[model samples]
Structure formats: structure tokens, C-alpha cells
Target: MKDLLNRRRLWVGGKGGVGKTSIAAALAVLAARRGKRVLVASTDPAHSLGDVFASELDDTPRRLLPGLDAMEIDPEREVEAHLSRVTAQMRRYAAPAMMDELERQMRLSRQSPGTQEAALLERLSRLMVDDDLPYDLVLFDTAPTGHTLRLLSLPEAMAAWTDGLLAHSRKSERLGKVLAHLTPGSRRDLASPFEEEGGDANHDPRTRDIAETLLARRRLFHQARRRIQDPEHNGFLFVLTPERLPILETARAVSSLEDAAIPVAATLVNRVLPEEADGAFLASRRAQEQSYLSRIDETFAHLPRPRVPWLPTDIQGVDALERLASCLEQAGL
Candidate 1:
């Protein structure tokens, strides 16, 4: 098979309780079988990748199927790592006790939703830059509507924040140096602790560099968002069940993505009733499905539509998932 996956990332998201994860996993499996290295990642805090794959996955990618790997990230872990880096930078000139107290306070501040998401994005950027485990395709199994929107909008939000932060950082660095040189006790008071600890206190160039890198990371968010909207590279798939509420939710999601100018490549209507009209129960279910499927067509006329019929057995193991993949492929996904 030839390579079919694009280097651009795929973002799978939709209303809460939608089978977004299942569809994302199927897409990754299909792409992998098509001879592309793929990573299907669960970016949602309440992740279910392990459950879907019937195996545990760490922050690092673990091979699940042929040519496909999976990773489940907990933003809390990323937040803790970010906090450590921040404290290390501050400890260059701060006293040990003072640094500890500052770190404690900063940890409290990171409890905010915005800070947690930023930390996760920073970690994700690092993974993207890593050369060792580069994959042809990346699928992000995102959180529900509200959280997913915040994650998607991080690019614009972080861009604006980065501009202001860069300016402020530069101004503060200059002010700090001037204050240290001009004021008698200012240099000694701040520099003494680091000097005693054998730490370089010449305003610590590393800290400045890290601040610049963090600002650059904010730019990476914008780049990632652009990659998502780029038709040749990224594919955004919104998954929904065949029901009135999920159908309505999918419509809202498509509108939101369009409003943000994010390109949506496809939609997956998951767990639909099989197209069999034999029994009364089955026939009634199929009728209901046809009704919503028509509704889906009207809403998602721009992209390809994929459907997953309800199977007798649960989709858990690789064998079952492969069956699911076959069904998706047959649907022209």
C-alpha cells in the first residue's frame, strides 16, 4: 500500500457522549492499514483510548495496531511539569524558601482552566517537534463541545497573549538589570542567594531564553490551528449518533468550526441501525435512522459522510475494531 496519510493533524470532536473517539480510532486504524504511520491520541481529560484499544497507553505513544500507536495525555501531568520548569527558572535568583513559597502560590494559580490548557498545548508542541517518533498522521480525540472549543481557540488566544507577554518580558528584563546596577542593596539582596548557591545570577540568560521559547510555543499553537484548517493536510471529523439531540449538536459544532474558519473534512454518524427491514424492532430503528441520516445530509453537504451500523458484539478488541474499520472504509471514509 502507498502512503495515504497527510502530515497534517486530524482533530476529532463533537458533542459530549458522541462516539468521536471510536470514529477517530477507526480512522487511525484505516490510515495505518493504508501504510501510513499514525498516532491516535486522546486529548480529552476523561480519556477512553485505553478502553477502546483494550490496553493501557501512556503519555508516550504505544503501538496498538500495525503502523498505528496511541497515547492518552493528562493535562495535570503537563501542568506539573510546566510548574517545575517555572520554579527552576525562578530559583536561579530566589532564595530556597522563597522559591518554594512562590512555587506553591503558582501551583494554586495554575488551577485555572486557561493555565491548564496552555500547559497541555505546550507539551503537545514539544511532542510535535520530537524527531524520534514522527508519524505521518496524528488524530486528536478531543474533549466535548465547551472544552474542545477552548482547545481549538487556544491558537488565537495564545497568539495575542504571546505578543503582550513578549513585550512585557523584555521590558521587565531591562528594568531588572537597571534596578540591580543602579540601586545599592538591590543587586546584593537579589544576587546574594544565588551567589551563595553557586548559581549564575548575571540575570540568568537561560531564563530569558525559556521565556522566549514559551512565546514561540504560543506561535506553534497558531500554526497547529492553521494546519487543522489546511485542506491538503488536516482533516477534522465530527462524530455524532443518529438521534435528534446529537444531530442538533453536530449542526452547532459544524457552525462553530466554520465560524472559526477551521476546515471540516468529514462527519461520522456512529452506531446507526443496520439497513435491515426484517423485524418490527429492527425496522422501526432503521426508519428512525433514515430520518436522522437525511437530517445529517442536509447539515453536512460539504464533506464526505461515514456511518457505523450497530453490530451484534461490542467493538473492543483489535479484531472487532478492524471490523469497524472495514465498515468505515466501505462507507468511503
Candidate 2:
């Protein structure tokens, strides 16, 4: 497997109970220790980056260690901001009487499925495109497998949607011009009926603005898609335990990601039991783990499988993450 730490963008995803966030944090700390500036952001609604870093975090990046920073995206807050921006843009193009109805529809749309994911993607795009940050690496601690997959797949869908919108906008503009030229006194009022009074009916600036915005968004999504699919720049790390369900899910996720042209750089088989355990229960569990471990080795034979030992206690805070990082280093990850 390629060195995931060498990538500019890394997305860590796995099953819910798997130690995805812990591994992501560990990687960030490890990179920072090697004198690299790193920004780790959590896209999971149920955040644990703050817990792992043992520090408060918000939407904006906050410095945790010398060269490490962390941030937790609030989906609710992002959704609200997304709605506000959309509504504001709509108001500029919509007629006064339609404002109430548009606002109502916008509010309703907020409750619809995928709104949060869309908002999160918008924020993720901003982070990826923003060049002002001095960080050498940006690691995304994503939600569970399914949600993260959907989020990664969104750019293609969004690009198609934007293309349709642009096509419609251009068609409408051309039709408006034709009607203005055909009608006796309509040349001066070529503006759309949706436009506010005194707005140019024939060449409405609002329409151009909307088209420009869609074009900009399309370009942004295109850039994000290219960045993710570029193996030399970005990597996807799927974390799974030595168990049935997580293994299956990880396999499916890897297949789906490859189908989407996004590279799955490596897999982390976390929480393997030690061979020196003495108790019968531990022995039995270890036996089962070994069986699963063999299966994992056979299944992901082509990918790098870095096994992490199960710690004596729950992993939290910087110390535990450092220990995990050390283990990862020892495993040659």
C-alpha cells in the first residue's frame, strides 16, 4: 500500500463502532510529530475528534499540538447556513409575492434527506479548495461507510444537476430574448415574470448571477472530484475490525469506491488480540480473531493490512493516540 501519510488529502471511514476517529487522530499526530502541518476535520455528526484531541473544537480549525489542528463540522449549523445562502440567492431572483412560498419550500427542504450531507460537502469543498491554510495535510474523519460513500459520490451527481440548471438557464435566456423581439412593446420588458419590478426583463442580472453561481459550484465539484480520484494526491483509508460485518462492509466500500474511480489506499485491521494472553476467554477470543485475521489477509491480500493490537483500556486523548501512532509506525504503515 502507498504511504497514506504522504497524501495531501486522506479520508478515513469505517463501521460505527470501529476506531476510525482514533486512527485518523493518530495519523494526524504522527504527521505532526514528523514536522508536517496537519489539519484533521471530522465530518461525522456524532463527533469524537474533540474527545481524541482532548480539546474544544468548532467549525474553524483550532490548534491542538504544535503542528496539528482539529475541527468538528456541525451539520445542523452547516444546514442552516446552506439554507440561508440558498434562500438569499433565491430572493434576489424571485418575485416579491413568491418570497413567502419560496421560504416555506426552503424550510421544508431543510428536513428532507441528504440536506446535511449536501451542506457538509459544500464545506468540504471549501476546505479542499482554500489555499490559504499552511497545512501540508488535511485528514477527514468521515462518518460511517454508507454515509461517507454517498458524500464522496456527490460530486458527479451535483455536476449533472448543475449542467441541467445551466442548460435551462441558457434556454430561458434565449427564449426571453426571442419573445422580446417578437412582441410589439415587450422589448423593454424582456425581464422574467419572476423578476422584481424595475428589474431588466430582457437581460435580468439575477439570471446571470444564478448561472454564474451554478457554474462556479460545478467547477468546484469538478475540482473536488478530480482531487479525490487522483491517487497521487488523495487517499481513502478504510478501517475495519477482525469481524464479519465490518469486513463485509469494508469490502463493499472498497469495491464501490474503486467503481467511482477513487482509490482505496489501504485498510487498517484494528484491535487484533495479542498471542501472549493467558485466560481461556481471551484465548478463545484470540483463536476466533486469528481465524478472521487469516480471512482478512486472504481477502485484502492486494492491499496493505496494518494490524493494531487491542489496548488494555479505551483509547482517548493525546497519550492514547500517540501510543496507537507508535503501534502504527511499528507496523510499517
Candidate 3:
């Protein structure tokens, strides 16, 4: 588990409400305590990073300790910002008559099903490729298993989509060249809505501009995927409780991540009943948990499994987080 600390990025994900946030926070605190500069950012729309750190945090990182910072991404805001960027770019080249129609379509897109995810992917890609990122490690406290899998897969999906656009762009360029060769200087009649008033119809600049834009975005997604899967620079840590559902969910999540080529480095088996707790009910609970624990070990036989004993109190602020971090250290995470 300690090997994960050497990587530049870590993604902590699991079924929701399984102490996922606490586990992520603990790991971040643990790394920070070791003098590594760390940024713990939440990708969950319903964020608990503020509660875990006992500090208010938004999209921008806020200092939580000497070597640690925390942030919670606002998905809605990212979506709005993303659409605005695309709209601005279109307005720069689109015909004036198309502006109203474009704005109307943009408004409709705000309600589109995948717009939020696409926007979040764009934001995440920027974070991944930013050369000015200051942290030694950036830990993503991700949404639950299902959402995380989709998010990780986006770099590939968007890249493919960009490739398709580029293919079309190339095809259009070929068609234009063929038309120009056949008609000579008579190509002005072929001008469409894309041409500016004074633009040369012999050579439409829109296709070239669109191709350049798509290529730049393609590079962004490519770099993001490259960083995400590079074993030496990244690792994905999964946190799960010793329960049937979380165990099964984790297995599926790990499988999806493996299919996507993201490095699944380790697993943290959180909230194992402590030996000191004594009662008939507690014993029965521990007995059930023992079976699950055995199942987890067997199912995820290849992963480095660390067991964190359940804590008696809530983990908030630096002191409580330190206790959890110590538990992580003792558990060999």
C-alpha cells in the first residue's frame, strides 16, 4: 500500500457511504504528514470534503494543513463554464444569422443528459495536464463506483469522438479540394454559412479552424489518459467495507478499471470491528464481517489489502484525521 504514495496521482473510489471520504482524507493526511505536498479534491457532486477537513472548500484548493489542501468540484458550474467556452468559439466563426439558433441550441444542451459528465471530463483533463500543478500528489476523492468507472472511461470515449470529428473534417477538406479543382475560380457559389463576409471561398478557413480545435482537444484527452494509466505516475486505490454489497461492487469496479487499463494498486478494508468491543450483538456482527473479510481477501487475492479497525468517534479536523492516518500507517496502507 505504501507503494501508492510514490505515484503522482491517486483515485480513491468505492460504494457511497462506506467511509469512502474518511478513508480518502486519512490517506491524504498520512501523505501530508510524511512531508509530501498533497491536494485532495472531491469529484462527488454531493461533497463531504468540507466536513471531513472541517474547512470550507470549493473548486479552488484551500489549505487544510501544512502540506495538505482540499477542494470540492462544482459540477454544475463546470458545465456552465464548458458550454460557454464552446458557444464563444462558435460565435467567433458562425454567421451572424446563426447566433440566435446557436444560443437556443446551447440552452437546450444545458438540459442534455451527458453534458455534465462531458464538462466534468473537460475540467478533469485540464487538471491532469496542467504543467503548473504544484502538489507532489493529487488525490481524487471520486464519486461512487459506477460514476468513477464512467469518468475514467471518458478520456478514451472523448478521444474517439474527437477522432471521428477529425475524420469528417479531413473528408470535407478533400471534398472542397475536389470541387475547387473542378470549378476553378467559380467556387464562390459553393460558399456556405461558415464563410465570413470578406472570406475567400476558394479556401474555407472554418474547416481548418475546426480541425485545429479538435486536434488540441484530442491532445488534451490523450495526455489525460496517458497520465491516468501510467503505472509509475498513478495508482487507483479502492476503499470498501467488509460487507457483501461493497465487496461485490468493488469486484465489478476493479474489473471495469482493469478493462480501462487504469492501475488498481491496493484496497483498504475499512471499518473492521475492533477486538476490544465486547458484546453478544457485536460478536455476531464481527462473525459476519469475518466471513466477508475472508471473501474479500479471496476475491481480490492479487491486491494489497489493508485492514483499518473501526474508530469510535467522527474524524474531523487535523487531530482526528491524524488518528485515522495513524491507523492507516499501522495497517500498512
Weakest 10 consecutive residues of candidate 2 by summed lDDT: 193-202
The C-alpha RMSD in Å for every predicted model, in order, reads 4.8, 3.5, 3.6
Candidate 2 Cα lDDT to native: 0.87
> Where is the poorest 10-residue window by lDDT in model 1?
191-200
Residue 55's lDDT within candidate 1 is 91
- Model 3 collision count: 0
Model 3 scores a C-alpha lDDT of 0.87
* Candidate 3 ranges beyond 4 A from true positions: 170-203
How far off is model 3, as Cα RMSD?
3.6
lDDT of 1 by residue, 1-333 (tens): 012246457788888877777777877888988888998989888989788889988888898877899999988888888788777776775777686689778878778758878877766665554556578888888888778777777877788877787667666655665566678666556532344444544345755665766767776776666556776766667889888998887788788888888877777788887766379888877888889899889888886777778777876778877888888877766
In terms of TM-score, how similar is model 3 to the real structure?
0.91
lDDT of 3 by residue, 1-333 (tens): 677887888989999989889988988999999999999999999999889888889999998889999999999999888888889988888899999999999999998987888888878888888868999999999999998888877776787888898777667756665565577565644644334455443355676677777788878888999989898988999999999999999999998888878899988899999999999999999999999999999999999999999999988887899999999999986
